[model samples]
Target: MNKPCFLLLCLVANGLFPVYAITPGQTEKENPMTINMSINQQTYEISLSDTAAAKAFVEQLPLTLNMEELNGNEKFADLAHSLPTRQSRPGALHAGDLMLYGHQTLVLFYETFQTSYSYTPIGKVIAPEGLKKAVGDKNIAVHFYRD
Candidate 1:
């Protein structure tokens, strides 16, 4: 092939050609948000985006997670249990409220058995909609409790 034709073919093969590409129904996964939940006085840190982190944190706790219907409108009471002594206040240490840190944004949500709290972090591709749905908004006030 001629030098010009060869160059053109190379450009096309290399995807250097300006082609209008439209990605539909493609939503980027939101950045990982750190949520600190205190159950029985032990602070359990987790990232909703990281399944491994969530699993590891849950495994270390004596509390069994009822993630069966994890979504909005779920209640913490429905999933609460008497954690084993190894995971309780004297055993594992837990924080007071659920602290979420994401993209320079820190959100604290109180746990409740009703409603949902909505959150939108700046520059975050994914919103904590699932969490809001699971935790509910009833105990979502920005108030901190000392145990």
Candidate 2:
């Protein structure tokens, strides 16, 4: 019995044997809807309620959304130049917190219902212009917040 127990301990210590399999509930699971972007060496993580919301946000972005370069760049003129034409729908518009990570910027937009939201990256100089161009001159009632 002593010999058998010693062998088992040795195997476990060397990672040659498993003491027991990890049960599903014992481990933390990854969140599927989290979006992480590194702009200019700074990292930003955005967590959403579900994958659908995340997908919707991504779909609204331009064809090329490269997080790494965005983080490093100082002026977003190039990124802004790449922005797709904005689509308009009937709802209130709310602007969330504007985050600056190095030279990259994040602008969050929320519609009236609050069920959906989207974010876009902008370089310092182009951020305000890009937002104004995206939002247009339409008047829509909306609740707003920023941090």
Candidate 3:
């Protein structure tokens, strides 16, 4: 086997690597890393990305943050600790994108817009129609937890 493939096999065999399956009509609840994000009294399901940063973020779950509003588009808070990052510019951001900036800042976008700044993927909120109203135009306390 090629060296890279052999290493991957070894990692899998040692239970040091994870494998995911994509099935037809699979729901977010079926995803092992899915989490609930609560703003005010409304809850949104977040489908976490398959990345090291997402895994690290999940490890610190059941957290509450007083996220500060920024630029009339997003809310952000500094994590108590840092996570691993694989940053990239996602040119167009949707309303429910949850991303990590640098190694410590956790950002939640509530608007659709283009950007040149790079961020690490954390997750995306499902059905975020009421999100903006829940957050309002001020800093809000948000909670994240696993069901």
Candidate 4:
């Protein structure tokens, strides 16, 4: 085993530490960060991905952005600052998939589609059934905050 994990095992075996089993897509933290995405008076809860970029995005939150429309499928806004990135090609994008493009651009997809671009995952909106309608056909004002 790796050194840190072996050390943890030893500590647990000696009754000096408690073990917590983290499930897939979960972190060791007691609580995952959640935020709200408000668009056109409709609110959606966002469960942030466990990533350094996501945490950095949260640090700049309580933000209002005028997101510009693109390709009839997504909205994007350029952030005042850049976040760390671990970019990957997800291949297929889903509605309510929040992502960062090139460390500085924030993107929210409102339609399911295939793509060749790479992006850093941010978070996903829970229950995104009406998301497409809420985002509409043009530029939009989106408010993000923690509560």
Q: lDDT of each structure?
A: 0.33, 0.33, 0.92, 0.94
Per-residue CA lDDT of model 1 for 4-93, tens digit only, reads: 999989898879656665543232234344444443343444444333323333443443332221233222222222211111122211
The lowest-lDDT stretch of 10 consecutive residues in candidate 4 is 24-33
Candidate 1: regions farther than 4 A off: 16-41, 48-110, 116-147
Candidate 3 local lDDT, 4-94, one digit each (tens): 9999889888796567777643753465468999998899999899879998999998899999999999999999999999999999999
Query: Model 2: how far is 43 from its true place, Å?
Result: 1.1
TM-score of 2: 0.23
Displacement of the residue 74 alpha carbon in candidate 1, Å: 14
Tens-digit lDDT track of model 4 for 1-147:
899999988888879656677785555345667999999999999989888999999999899999999999999999999999999999999999999999899999999999999999999998899999999999999999999
Model 3 scores worst on lDDT over the 10 consecutive residues at: 24-33
lDDT of 4 at 36: 99
**lDDT tens digits, residue span 1-147, model 2:** 699999988888879655786765344235223344333333334443232323444444432332222221111222332233222232333332222222233333422233222333221111222333333344322211111
TM-score of each: 0.26, 0.23, 0.79, 0.82
What C-alpha lDDT does candidate 3 achieve relative to the native structure? Answer: 0.92
User: Top model by TM-score, which number?
Assistant: 4
Candidate 3, which segments miss by more than 4 Å at Cα? 1-32
